[model samples]
Target: MIRPRHILRVFLLTTLLTTCLTGLSACGFVGFPGVYKIDIEQGNLVTQEMIEQLQPGMSRRQVRFIMGSPLVEDTFQPDRWDYPYVIRNGPDIIREAQVRIFFEGDSLVDVTGDYLPSWANPNAEPQGSTESEETEEAKES
Candidate 1:
């Protein structure tokens, strides 16, 4: 008893609903863009090799020749350097590296503010100490 028009209408309705459902599946979706990118591999992280190659007495020009421009240098001391790097996905990823060097006199004695942590606490000293040789030297002097 179904008419041809009624059958056509049902078929069209089902088709429209299926298409709408498929499209909506993507429209209402969120967090899916970066969902597959949750894992951040630490393998891409660079090591201190950059700084290790720099000898204590190397000049700024020599340092630059070896390590390129620094990422950061100290503001006040202008002798300590700091490098930071991070690596994300492969091609569609985030990767960066930083370098710092300090100087003494005209020669590069120490690396200072290259382009990072320029405002770090100046009073803070690195870990481990057996009383500075300066203290002993001063006492003897």
Candidate 2:
């Protein structure tokens, strides 16, 4: 004894529910549009300026003041301090960098990893060459 109007309402509701379920499932497969993804940053952020300020023979206290506390300080390698940084946007990594500072006793000896001080750059123009060039120019004058 169902009326025609009741049957139509039920059919419409069922169709609407099915469509909603299908759309929600599709959203699971291909993330919902317009969703905001946050950029996540972690660990010490060492910049080029920080690296440039480093100099060999600096005291451990001076190095720490310039570079900040390290992210990893291994007990086995007490002389080495590791600074690692990462930036991620959702599931993708945007950037990753690391710097390892080594010390001999309480004196900073070496620095390595993604960034290096100007003194440590192998491809940098030699300081001696620039001085020699300046002297040659003066002699020519």
- Weakest ten-residue segment in model 2 by summed lDDT: 118-127
22-122, model 2: which lDDT tens digit per residue?
99999888997799999999999999999999999999899999999999999999999999999998889999999999999999888899999878888
Please give the lDDT score at residue 125 for candidate 1: 64
Candidate 1: list runs displaced more than 4 Å. Answer: 1-30, 33-49, 89-100, 108-141
Instruction: Look at candidate 1 and tell me the lDDT of residue 33.
Output: 53
| CA lDDT scores, all candidates in order | 0.58, 0.93
TM-scores, each model vs. reference: 0.36, 0.70
Compare the candidates by lDDT and give the number of the best one: 2
In angstroms, give how far residue 40 of model 2 lies from its true place.
0.6
